[model samples]
Target: MKAYFYLLFLIFSLTSHGSYGQRPTYSEDEIIVKTVTDEMDQVFKSPDFLKKKNKQFQDITGTMVVDIGIIQSGKVATFYKVENTITNIDFINFVSEYILQHKFKFKLPKKMRHKIRYSITF
Candidate 1:
């Protein structure tokens, strides 16, 4: 009887640990936001890109709003909107192109498309 009880307890403890083990701290949405921010940071910090951007707008300082759509396959399907506080046509075009060229590195469920509105500050 003692051996049988110990075996049962061991099985229960193992199963319980498996079911409630370590979990991710960040939510799915937060993870996606972090991914996007990290990618954008790389783009903003690139030497060649920064040189070009600086040449166009020496003192550019504002926020740019970007609306991105992600398909079920996790690909960036479209760039719906790109708006910035600085109303320079050249600046908008350059930034818009840079954003549109970026490839997001994440996946979503196959049920429906996901849309995210992200802001970039300069």
Candidate 2:
């Protein structure tokens, strides 16, 4: 049993800090991340985000991905990257502003900050 536990710990230690294929550098931060929760569904659908919607473009319809960074205080500080294939400034701004208004349900431990990737269909 002790050997099994030791092996498990070894696996976790080796994999925890290993980044595959040039992942974003979080070396300086002692981050603890959890999957986005059901509460985020409400945040995403809330009136705050809906109010910024622009339906002016009939031809543009797809998923927009954003990597949002949140400080340990649980507030979204910045969007590291926005993946809009069409490069629509208005749509990007709408999403970015909407995300800034919301906070993550999960709080990082040890006052560490982290980033999360999310997508919304337009």
Candidate 3:
């Protein structure tokens, strides 16, 4: 009878301890955003996309801030220039139109199907 009771106690203890072990947690939106942002940074750094428009103007320096809205379909639904050099308005507008026409892919969780804001500066 003592052996049976000891065995029962051991089993109960093991079962309770198992529940206390590490449990898997769901991914958060912040993690998703960080991952997508990193991927986009890599894409921008690639030479395939950043082609030189003017070879003669080697010293041309300007920065443009693009605001993009990622739709649920993983495409750029809307794009606009939020900020940029005053002299580069035409360039910024052209890029914004081009981005809107092109399709983009982003890895996002199903739960976050809503639109997401992204900013690009170059």
Candidate 4:
């Protein structure tokens, strides 16, 4: 009976993990990118001081989409996967921090934002 139980447990574990093999996992960067983008959208909609500041920096108006990997301790491990023409690193870094600090308010679209896994994108 013990041998049979062990075999059953092995089979169950294998089956459970087998289905997950086909799925893709998100890196840390992907999570950060999504977090930032969603936060920015939310901040833009709410009437607040940040919105005014965002507007004031109109020169940095171009969309900056970045893939960032943030650890649980809130440290950014990677910051190079940005997909934008803007060269203002300071602003991008500031936005990244802002996103991390605030709770995400915007509900991301299922199709477009669903790709984000463990990382965030802007």
Best by TM-score: 1
For every candidate in turn, the CA RMSD to the true structure comes to 7.8, 11.7, 10.4, 11.4
**Compared with the true structure, what per-residue lDDT tens digits does model 4 show for residues 7-122?**
99999998898765342333354564666556556665566735654665556655565554444333343544346655777776676665445433223322232323232222
Best by lDDT: 1
Candidate 1 has which clashing residue pairs, if any?
none
Off by over 4 Å in 4: 1-40, 49-56, 68-81, 105-122
TM-score of each: 0.60, 0.56, 0.51, 0.38
lDDT of 3 by residue, 1-122 (tens): 99999999999998889756443232466764665577567665666446643432334456655656665445666776666664655555655665665444443344444333556655
lDDT, residue 62, candidate 4: 59
Candidate 2: C-alpha lDDT: 0.62
Runs in model 2 lying further than 4 Å from the true structure: 1-37, 54-60
User: Could you tell me the C-alpha RMSD of candidate 2 in Å?
Assistant: 11.7
Q: Against the true structure, candidate 3 has what lDDT?
A: 0.57
Candidate 3: Cα lDDT at 93: 61
Candidate 1 regions exceeding 4 Å error are 1-27, 72-74, 80-83, 109-112
**What do the candidate models score in CA lDDT, each in turn?**
0.72, 0.62, 0.57, 0.51
Per-residue C-alpha lDDT of model 1 across residues 9-119, encoded as one tens digit per residue: 999998888745443233277676776677777878889788988887888889888887766555677775467787777887787777666665555655666667878
Report the Cα lDDT for residue 120, model 3. Answer: 62
Q: Which stretch of 10 consecutive residues in model 1 shows the poorest summed lDDT?
A: 19-28
